[model samples]
Target chain A: MPLSEFDIIARYFAQATPGRDDVVLGIGDDAAVIDPPAGQQLAVVIDTLVAGVHFPLETDPYDIGWKALAVNLSDLAAMGAEPAWLTLALTLEQSDEQWLAGFSRGLSELAGQYGLQLVGGDTTRGSLTVTVQVAGYLPPGQALTRQGAAPGEEIWVSGTLGDAALGLRLVQGGLEAGDSAAEQLCGRLNRPQPRLSLGIALRGMASSCIDISDGLLADLGHVCAAADCGAALQYADLPLSSAARDLIAADSGLGDLPLIGGDDYELCFTAPADRHTDIQVLAGQLDCPLTRIGRIEVEPGIRCLEQDGSPRSVTGQGYRHFNESS
Target chain B: MPLSEFDIIARYFAQATPGRDDVVLGIGDDAAVIDPPAGQQLAVVIDTLVAGVHFPLETDPYDIGWKALAVNLSDLAAMGAEPAWLTLALTLEQSDEQWLAGFSRGLSELAGQYGLQLVGGDTTRGSLTVTVQVAGYLPPGQALTRQGAAPGEEIWVSGTLGDAALGLRLVQGGLEAGDSAAEQLCGRLNRPQPRLSLGIALRGMASSCIDISDGLLADLGHVCAAADCGAALQYADLPLSSAARDLIAADSGLGDLPLIGGDDYELCFTAPADRHTDIQVLAGQLDCPLTRIGRIEVEPGIRCLEQDGSPRSVTGQGYRHFNESS
Candidate 1:
């Protein structure tokens, strides 16, 4: 017999994470009641992932669950918020017990790491889709936003760029797979980490911050647009993994991926030049790579310069779902 | 020349509701930040509506927007929470300007009534789907849950039952349409008013409550299961609109609808027998019809008795998304 909706929830989703004191009521209720701390404000974000749109349909369910939650956490992380509670609205084509089990495991493992409780959500039968909403806590008047960058501020990014986009190519058979580097890139595509710790550490140090879900140039374009500033990027300063460098070296056309590819899930932030030393020390303590990629400029457009200071024209404006060609 | 993702958000969704002081940041950011009051606990709920499954594919976009938010608010209402914030995840096959305009209007009008500010969400390209998550405030320790009903408590339901189910039939062409009664039923199906005021008023009085989304018998079954009790309903006492009554009189086979039909979005609750007079007064104040349909029992199952005291067997258990047949 096929599992009913209630059975699926009870067996796979009801106990996804341990109970938290702030969660007065968790799963198995019409709505979850939560007690937010008195002094802290809440940061809420929602994101949807559709099969064959956000990811390939053949992607593992485990990776789907992990990536779904990770993307929303990335948004909260950009705001320097502490992870709190989550609600999931899952629409599946059918109730496959194995798929549900894998997805549950992936979601619960990450949720347990952050002390996040799965509060309440709806599970329905439809085309495969996952929508996750996360609410986190932020100190009053201290939220990091995109509108705080200033001219001459140093732009910094954590982790390598373009790996996830490269990973997607490998997953889609556009690139040759089976190599160790290929596997690593594919892993990056499947499970991009949310930079929560770095976001929290840079609370007072960084002037503005955003997660690089829509490529370096495009997401930074958003920050620049919001701050009413521009940015100048040193091409050599952009961080790249050895695999990405190798691929780009083999075919220079692939060099644009580091600038135009989406789904990196790394932080792109700007801060005063004098804070550079402090950011380096913080990066060492956190054991996360931090690269100084560019600087905010008074001009009102993004520029990428070569080592000789010549400009390179970039064409793509990152990924948009409803563009004319798409 | 099609609208891009960002354009769609900025034009149709960014300013769907008036700005509120609690919303520190609204749209056009990585996430939204909100400030909750000191003395209140937050109640959170999420629901999803998929085209061709939850509603007909040709249904009006305005009703789709209204209902997506309404169902989630209904859950909060069931918990006696005051509506506060909402996040929507909309998945569309294409970006249609006319559809977007209608959806925004319907969403904004309802949100204005409740002072609900749209915080943040994602707009993605995929099959047509709408997922809404709502956060509301509840006085500390004052939320109504399904576990509070005791034996011998009277079960009462607000407004008419089975109207939305009949409305669905009319919309689906299962029943003849175009009459005033059919139009009224269709309207009931599309726009379910979440009983927020009534729910708030019942906070101190009702022992247990649930919104009737999945039929009267099935929802009462949930309350009974949670409270570890049973219910006995009087068949003659079930409230019905004139249209529904006339339809049932014409065909006895449709009699089970009021008992087992779903999507009523009305509150079914249990309270102490002593509070009957107070509840009647509340009904008069709210101008919403209230019906005393049943009583909680010491037994472990639900029963429906005719006026002469004969029991009627109920075989349906309301709607479940992933049942064997579904």
Candidate 2:
């Protein structure tokens, strides 16, 4: 017997309710009901991942599901909000029970980890696409935004960058890596950890923040635009994973990928220079490195400089979703 | 210059946000910030419409945009909530400036009418697909749910049924109609009016309620399942538009189309028989017709009755998103 839409939702998507006190009504209704905490504003965002666009069509269903929710969580992390609820809209060409099982596992696992309740969503038949809208809450006036950076503030980035971009290259056969290193690179490309804890920790410390989804420069540009300032970065100071460093050593051409590679899912933030020790303590407490690689400048455009006080020449632009070649 | 994602959003999706006091922050951010009113719970839902699946691929982009948000409003109305914020995730195969302009106009018109603030969303490159997630607010304990119907309550529906289904048939050339009637029917199909006002009127009075997207019988089945009761409907009592009645009068076989046809976008509810006069007054106040077509029964399955007390059999099931033959 063919699985109906209802059957698909019940069998795979109807996860065990996490006993959320705020979710008054969850799945199985026309809409979910949530009683948000007092004095906390809701932060919401929606993102769509289409096959052959966000990820390779041949990517594992589990990885696709993980990445879909992970990216949305990253947005919430950027805003310094604790994830409270999420809704998924999944479009599939056909029903594959095994694929559904794997996908559901990946989604449920991440949702469980963060205490996010999968409150409501839709399942439809079409070309494969996954759209996730997440809701998080932060105390009124406490939520971080990309519009608060001031001149002379230090810019910090959580976690190493560019591993995911390299992972994509390795998986697509555009680049090659050794065995264990290949596993780590491909995993980075397939599964990114949202810096929720880091975001929460930097709530009052960081003046402005954003997630690195469209590479470092592009996302940081958003911060600059919102904050009405410019940024200057020491290109050599960008934190890089050993895997990415080795890849760049073998091919100097790959050195610029971290600057323009997308899907990093790490928080790029600006904080006062006096709070440098506080950020260092946060990094130690969370076991996540927070590196200061730049500073907000008075100018109007982003500038990349070498260690020797010389400008570095970069090639290509950041990822644009609408560009025909993307 | 190729349109960047940010450029597309600013030009098309960054609508003049309705002055919603609850929307602390709206478009152009990583996520939107909203503060639901105190003493109210949030009703949230997400829906997706794919090209050639939910609607014809040739349908106008304007109509597609309107219908995408309209259908989500229908869900919110069914919950007796007032819409507050919405986020859209649109994926397209390519960027067409003309199409985007028309779509944004249609979206802005409807959003402006309902005071729905377009908070934040994402636009990506892929096969045409539109996903909208809406958030509304209702009193914490006054939500009209599908589980509140009593066994002896009267079942009611709002507006006319089956017109959109007939419209689909006419448009697809499966059925024929006059030009004026065709235009009327097609308008009903493409531009469904979500019964927001009537839904608010029915809040305290309605025992159970749902929007009729998947035909009367199919949607009523959901009510029955949730209420733990059966339903008995007099087939001849279903409110039908003049165009639909005339079409059915020509061919008796087409009579069942209204019974199981989908995309009505009308409300189906159950209330006490004593509230009949109250509902009548509500219909007058809201300027929407209320038709009492059936009653909740103690049995386990839905039954259809002819005027002469004979059993009527439905020919086909309502539209299911995943049904291969639908």
Model 1, A1-326: lDDT tens per residue? 77887898899989988789999999887899999999999999999999999999999999999999999999988999999999999999988999999999989888888999999889998999999999999999889999899999999999999999999988888886449889889888998889999989989999999999989999999999999989999988899999998988887878889998999999999999999999999999999999999999999999999899999877676887989495
What is the DockQ score, from 0 to 1, of model 1? 0.83
What is candidate 1's lDDT per residue for B193-294, written digit by digit as tens?
999999999999999999999999989999999989999999999999988988878877778889998889999999999999999999999998999998
| Model 1's TM-score against the true structure | 0.99
The local lDDT score (0 to 100) that residue A299 gets in candidate 2 is 98
Q: Candidate 2 residues B134-238, lDDT tens each?
A: 999998887778788889999999999899999998878889999988998999999898988887788899999999888888888999998788999999899
Candidate 2 lDDT over residue span A82-190, tens digit each: 9988999999988788889988888888888998889989998888999999999988888888899999999999989899999999988999989888898888888
Q: Where's the lowest-lDDT run of ten residues in candidate 1 chain A?
A: A169-178
What is the DockQ of the complex in model 2? 0.72
CAPRI docking class of candidate 2: medium
> Residue A146's C-alpha lDDT in candidate 1?
92
Per-prediction TM-score, please?
0.99, 0.98
Instruction: Report the TM-score of candidate 1, chain B only.
Output: 0.98
Q: Tell me the fnat of candidate 2.
A: 0.78
After superposition, which runs of candidate 2 have C-alpha atoms over 4 Å from their true positions?
A: A324-326
